[model samples]
Target chain A: MTDRTPGTRSSSGYSAWRLIAEELRAEIGDGRLRAGDRLPTEAALAERFSVNRHTARQATATLAEDGLVESRRGSGTYVTGEAMRLHRIGVRTRLTKSLGEKASASGNLRVLNSAVEDAPTDIARRLALDGGKAVRIETTRSAGGQQISMSTHWFDVSRLPDIATVLRRTGSVTSALRESGVDDYVRTSTVVGARHATASEVAVLDLGQGAIVLVTEGLDSLTDGTPLQHVVTRFAAQRVRLDIEHPRAD
Target chain B: MTDRTPGTRSSSGYSAWRLIAEELRAEIGDGRLRAGDRLPTEAALAERFSVNRHTARQATATLAEDGLVESRRGSGTYVTGEAMRLHRIGVRTRLTKSLGEKASASGNLRVLNSAVEDAPTDIARRLALDGGKAVRIETTRSAGGQQISMSTHWFDVSRLPDIATVLRRTGSVTSALRESGVDDYVRTSTVVGARHATASEVAVLDLGQGAIVLVTEGLDSLTDGTPLQHVVTRFAAQRVRLDIEHPRAD
Candidate 1:
């Protein structure tokens, strides 16, 4: 709040309201303002910025347009939860770890369906099965009662026949793999892309059809170099930001 | 192609048209069909898939809907250049390497604008230069005459006073940094997100307003751990996919 008065459009020449909005955005970005915290009243903001109430309202309006804040009819404007959740992706990236160990109790995996089917060409090629059959699992993962991602995972049924059963019991892919005697696996490659959510994705993720979905296609291989699984995950972009940690080349 | 006859709905129970589209999509995905390659005519596809012309037409329609192919009317449809350019994100990832050395002559960075201004709060904080002035460079990178990304970069002006001059001479950030006598740098962090393109982005990227843009915010630091710059790049979703290579923990 260091004199964010936007004095006469210093160097950047940004309008006063725009500067105010930017300051608020920075506050949220840097954690000075947390998600869902109600902003000060317009009068307070105006007095602080040495501006009129109308100017303060304009700033809030700008924030709303950026999906950073929400205004209530009777209450003050509050920051939206759009600061975004950072999902770190690494060689050993684990969804469970990213979601947090404490979240496990409150989170659950809903297996929409499971079936044995001829692997799609892309999945088949990635898994090196070449037209072989695989177990396809459609699942939605939720954390703290909020939907996080919808994923379709394909695994060669020949290698792990009891995955669905184990998954159902454990609600954990790692646990299921361990039960199936996989021991361990590591992600070999990940292809990240983005697209507008489809109709089904919109309904499944409870997001707008036009919303963006961060698509990740990953291939995991066992320590012995045997391909184990190929998965496609669609993450709600508004809620998740992918943090890629590149290892140092020593 | 692998008897993609669709056989009046294979074991998966997908419709003949859907199976046909899947087969074609696979061909494109697997590099069998290249961008700009003309797809088989409806009659040819009908004969090949053992379906009627109507079914083949429906398949092409589905591909068109998915943005995998475009109908050219009178002429056969062509595979859209959406097979995706994989941009690897790693500690030592280089844009030149991702775009390929062969593309260097064809790919060029077009400087849209540059200005010296008080650093925006978010950029300032990321560069650890709050309230400091920086040089902002706006650039659009093109490879083989097609726009790939639009990036805005901020660097401490005090450290690199002649960045704009060097950038203009070399048309590369790395080259400019080298010219400014800053030898080595490494990416410390990268945050990847996505959102619908804005009007200006839609125009610049030649995409629809609702088209997705892959946003990456990255920080680079000197080898000695001093922060050097912050950059925000928006990539056209349809044109690029980020390949994240996680180092093997041997």
Candidate 2:
């Protein structure tokens, strides 16, 4: 009554279920499991692997833990990566447009605070400014009514004295910068990471306990690589999938 | 002695701590507070924000929860994002190099199993195979002697019967593909997300409870976007940072 896949060791190294997870993970990696594609039913996997359905569920659960797949309520497990609303990271990516259907518009952005503050050493360095005070703006953003991101921005007050007023009115950082005689800027670099939501973040983002948020600290620069802005953002990991694209090397 | 930051709301909307977090987060965003940089001491921030040390600690803790800042043992809080160890995402990125010190060579790879398996419909489609059998390979990888990633790979048996042997011998997937007549390939796109670690993953990754991992499901192509490989990789988010870069427009 001991059913197992033929021609594989069962008791030596990894268990039967882990072996299955390995294969499934490979499939996901190799593009067999595209984002948003539903995995086989537990029964189907169990029968195929000659194991019980419980073992099959274990395999999918591991994928869920890694954010590779997710189990929807009453539905089956779906490949999670790249399936959620896509947030494109690129030179000219617009904040709202990149979120696609998940985000409403810049109009929905909330300007929570604006003040003049000491430009910390690093901040002053990136902005090409000397040690001085700068304009700081704090904002929270949402997607489809769910709070998704929170950000803080700093600008050299002497360069953009009206930046706070423009940011409050437009709710768009790009527009605000443009009005200050900076015609255009592009994202120069982005470093991405993830961590658990803070207690305060949970209250704002409405996350369940142990929820993770994707953090990005990025720099924007003018065409010739003059740094203009440095921003850090926390995105609710469940609502967004980040697509990091690299251009062809000529 | 109710000292507060002058000209800001206190008893109206958010509490003082939340507003402090908001301000600090903005600093992080705008490059005032940079990744890897130590924040002001609790006493210093308390004086700066005009709040008590308890309130200041609460603000920093919120940043920590969001993975923006981290408190080290006796080392104070440091920004957690961009500084954790940069994992550069680019067309020519090498796995070991991208990880910096976090990964060793492909020599650390261990092949767990190899067998022939039916190509699931989706897997078949991405691999450009019909409904037929394919070779499956499973492997677990480590960094600095710590288990970091596990992967499964599939190849059309007819196209490369010796793939498993080649991968095992060279310990490099690119070399294996190279031996099979694929001269070169590039990462076409990548989808990045994060989630909690599973029980099995926790044991393998040696992570504390509620730890998060960065999952990337990416596609590699033969310079023409002709899909060559699809892979999902899980990285301990604490050990690595991913830099998603955008190339300049000529």
Candidate 3:
């Protein structure tokens, strides 16, 4: 740790617990505090921040509520955010491959649903469709029996007519496309963000009531640059980190 | 519209309301349902899902609670997610530059806190520091008078002893570093992810009680790869999306 004063008395209007919690959160986020590390006792925290014990308790309580820390009944409070596993994205960026061995159930991908649908305007544009319907595939991927991500992929039906069935059989989008005679597709673009897990996401991903999901929208194309698939994938934020790789700069 | 059934009968053990909510969430996520769009009435939703009105009502209520949809008295339920704006990251992903003009309050950057601290191991390695203290600068970024991100940037004190004071004075990291005798830098690595907003984040970012922050850990180095700064930035997920550009595939 810094050994310097908190120096994080950054917000004037925020509550005392808030500033303390933010400081602790930053330490945890940056690895100065790791999982299983015991936090200072309430009295210690109180003296350190020049606040009352109750205020210190409130700060720890806030971290506990967010699953960032856990308060043992007798033992001291401890950090709980287990150094998030990294998910790397690059020129090829395949979910199953990028997730590596970490995303597991023994690591399996399953098709939850599939059907043909009139392309939504946005999906159609991304797939470069010309008045044709698209095959939609919904899937869930798990690691250690916990759902890691839910992906919905859309493909131009005229080009990959049996993509839905093939995906179900192959249990892999990359393989499904290859079976449909389109081998060696490349990721064209990726847009990332985050959002609160919805009610459905909570139940399906088995997340806590107010958890968050890291969302990635991607497109893959033929070597010739023809758009082949559009996918929206949401990963359990608590479990995944994204590593973006770039070529050396000038 | 799909012209087909919702096709989201994806979950087996989940309740009827959860299935309906999940299907609706996917539509909203993919832009089939956009901001300010009126959702089908409860009666319509029940008929479409083969469920009862109460089940349908529960679904809409959940969306309302998450701020994804809202009930407008007798008018009807409608989608409320505002089509997230994009934040692009590249070799030189300057927050002020990447955010363009969308991040507001006249788009000014200000120091929240600055100090000299013993460098944490992870940050020490990132900045290539050698047992020396580091200059830490904490900042919050805002747009439209709303906080967008909170960042903590660390620089090796031995190499840039005047960074903290310089950053506070210039109010711009790029300009501050230039004045510190480092005229050129390149972003060599970036790791992105998301997490639920901590108590402090909710207060400073002016987010809903249960919100998420899109996080990016970045490392910038001088032209010859001598580490310059290590920053951890957390953005309000509701307001910003990250656009990651890559070199076209082979």
Q: RMSDs, each prediction?
A: 10.0, 9.6, 7.4
Instruction: Please give, for residues B27-68, the per-residue lDDT of candidate 2 as tens digits.
Output: 565456677899898899889877788988877876676567
In terms of docking quality, model 2 is: acceptable
Give residue B181's error in model 3 in angstroms.
3.3
Candidate 1 local Cα displacement, residue B197, angstroms: 0.9
Residue lDDT tens for model 1, A155-176: 9988888898778778888888
lDDT of 3 by residue, A119-157 (tens): 778788888787888988888887654577888889888
Q: Give the count of colliding residue pairs in each prediction.
A: 0, 8, 6
lDDT of 2: 0.71
Error of 2 at B207 (Å): 1.7
Q: Over the stretch A10-72, how does candidate 2's per-residue lDDT look in tens digits?
A: 321234565566567546654567888999999999888877888888768766755668898
TM-score leaderboard ranking: 3, 1, 2
Every model's DockQ, to 2 decimals? 0.25, 0.25, 0.29
Question: TM-scores for chain A, candidates in order?
Answer: 0.72, 0.68, 0.76
Sort by DockQ, top down from the best: 3, 2, 1
What ranges in model 1 sit over 4 Å off? Answer: A1-69, A100-102, B1-68, B72-75, B105-107
